[model samples]
Target: MSEQSVLFVEDDEALRFATVQALELAGLSVRAFAGAEAALAALPTDFDGVIVSDIRMPRIDGLQLLARVRALDKDLPVILVTGHGDVPMAVAALRDGAFDFLTKPFATDHLVAAIARALERRALVIENRRLRAALAAGETDSPLIGESAAMVRLRGAIERLATADLDVLVEGETGTGKELAALLLHRLGPRRARPFVAVDCTTLSEDGGAADLFGHAADSVAHTRLSRVGAVVASSGGTLLLDAVDDLSPAIQAALLRVIEEREVQPIGAERAEAVNLRVVATSRGDLAAAAAAGRFRGDLYHRLAITRLHLPPLREREHDRMLLFAAFVDQAREALARPDHAIGEAERHHVLAHGWPGNVRELRNYAFACVLAADDAPGEDRQDLPSRVAEFETRVIVDALRASAGNVVKAVELLGIPRKTLYYKLGRYGIDPDAFRRQGT
Candidate 1:
């Protein structure tokens, strides 16, 4: 394994040289500086090393250096060396965020142990930062693919919304990429470095609501004995994506409304209110307006959320981009399967375009995966067998579309190419109840 780096700052030449030699013998890279000024000048913001320094030094002292390091990197550990009489000053350093204080004439083993712990802490911090960067990259690269006019407009809207800080309401059918859009907004927005919290309103219940969204204090009656950190607190300086806001209970809705209106959040058991700086993006598959009219949703909440509503049209309406989306999905499936590049035959492309994908891009992706798997299993099958496989594929597609479209004959006919009479016949043949597919609203 590679050696960890250590920066040792001590005014005493004998102690500094001896310490450097000891650390070097232990397979660590040591940089010795006789004063704090030299060490501070050489330190870079991205330096990954444990800092060991004597508490008493001329010109710039160890405490001053510790403060400077804290300003640059709070996670960087600083271990202070002190004499028996200087223990009081060492304790003061601890209150100022020093990692730990060591008495002089300390055992070599004790010094090595402290250095190991500090290096381990530095490693963990670096790993966390790396993971966060990877996550942000994924968000930027994996955007929704479509070329229809509606999709183009939606993309433009996202680009515009991402530049500002405002509440967003994304209205779309299930699997229409609302969450993906929210992520894009976050990655492109000013709060990109902050948290991106997602909350499912449908899953929020009174039993553990506070514990789930707002963390409990160490001492409180409703603490539940187990400390919990809520998503709202986790996403302090970023964006919060509230999925299915229509399902928010009245009480929880009121709490969320206050949070949004006041721009602050009070913990479940805390007396003080903590300020929150985040953009709110709410998504829903149902019609909020109708829900509000039916008393199923709060009118005030709906108005607050609908400040800038962007609707995602169903895939069936985006006929111009159907083939483009199909090709994209094929490429994604190929990469995922680790297969050689594959192309959709002209016939296969035509078959895909003929049907209306009611399940939207999600259904197309599933079909692509299934088709690839089937082809892999029967590598030698001729085009003569293609129709049977295609028919099976069509059946599955129709079933999913019907389920998503809720069996409305006209919508089903629009989604599937079959006539209204033929759709009803297939629904009966497939043991599907048309009434069960009907949504609450026409």
Candidate 2:
């Protein structure tokens, strides 16, 4: 089935057939089940669709099914339908994390609209997860790419710690790629094939935040009817990244300390604690030690999470890597936008060198794309024509290749993926002295 399809459960044969027909006519792809058991059994862990079930069913009812689905994947949208629903039941369902509730005799349009909205939200959630993973994992071999000494040391530490399986705390400023470092640790570690779940502590609210991270048992949380799995449990056998860990509420921090200490989580209202095996990677912008000492953060939690630590240097501190990263980002942007190569003019080079890049690589990458897209709009003769820009890009590429190859024309040609004669022709056209690089390196 396509990820865009839906799973629908209803016990009534006539209503099930009629609703399925209506949903199909409304251009939705749906799989109809006679009971909740069948639907629950067919559920996929990475299901990207919506679930609509009649709340008043035998054996496994809609609310029970919703609870099970939440335990499986909290983000999966479950819409409960019942002709017997009262105001309180509906309110309770919503509070219990039901996506939406519909009463029978409800208009076909109303159900369809509800399903559409649920599907839309599901798509956004899935896409956000995908994009976040991609951003953290990156499109390159190494998530952290630079030749700076700080980067080299950080990479070595990460490689060593990744295999040790110790919980790690990454300290860095915003946009310093803390998430990326956490992801690298996950990827390079034994849990590479497992889930990499990242939670933003800043967005965790006091009202239901603990339930969100630690999960809740059915009826454990007030006005809630479902048992939901939390992120900590969801990341079992993998890596749980606590981004901005210092931002966690004191209550959550205290709860998290137990999970880290015991390697088990007791769900709200649950009788037994469940054992979980996962690596925890926490990131903090501020000094967690200071926060803990000041009582702003839990001292015990910080000490537990900091079993191993990696600190990423800000962009300004990596002076040697600025131009290298800028060039790479520009190339990526040009390729993504399917545009002609962007000539790095004096203005761009100067800005790359001079700017503080408070947002680090993220800010630099955005600027690179902006420059590529706005190349034509550069003011006062700073912008060159397509041919001139292409020529300039060509020169830079050849120079870089030569530098990498130690000015060995044969090696440079191979590195550039070009014919030797073609590389020679370009080198002659651009007036680049290959021997200059050779003398400096080889």
The top-ranked prediction according to lDDT is 2
> Compared with the true structure, what per-residue lDDT tens digits does model 1 show for residues 218-302?
6553525655667887887899999888878888888888888888888777878888877999999988989989999888888
TM-score of 1: 0.53
The window of 10 residues in a row where model 1 has the poorest summed lDDT is 381-390
- Candidate 1 achieves a global lDDT of 0.75
lDDT of 2 by residue, 1-442 (tens): 2348889999999999999999898999999999989998898877889999988899999889989999988889898887521435666676677887776556688788878878876775575454334444653347586768898888889899999999999999998899999999999999999999999999999988999899999988888798999999999999999999999988898899999999999988899999999999999998999999998998889999998889999999998777767777877898999988565665677798899999998999999999988885664343224455445445645666777779999987766666788877887889999899999895
The local lDDT score (0 to 100) that residue 103 gets in candidate 2 is 61
Off by over 4 Å in 2: 1-141, 379-442
lDDT of 2 at 102: 71
Would you list the C-alpha lDDT of every candidate in the order shown?
0.75, 0.83
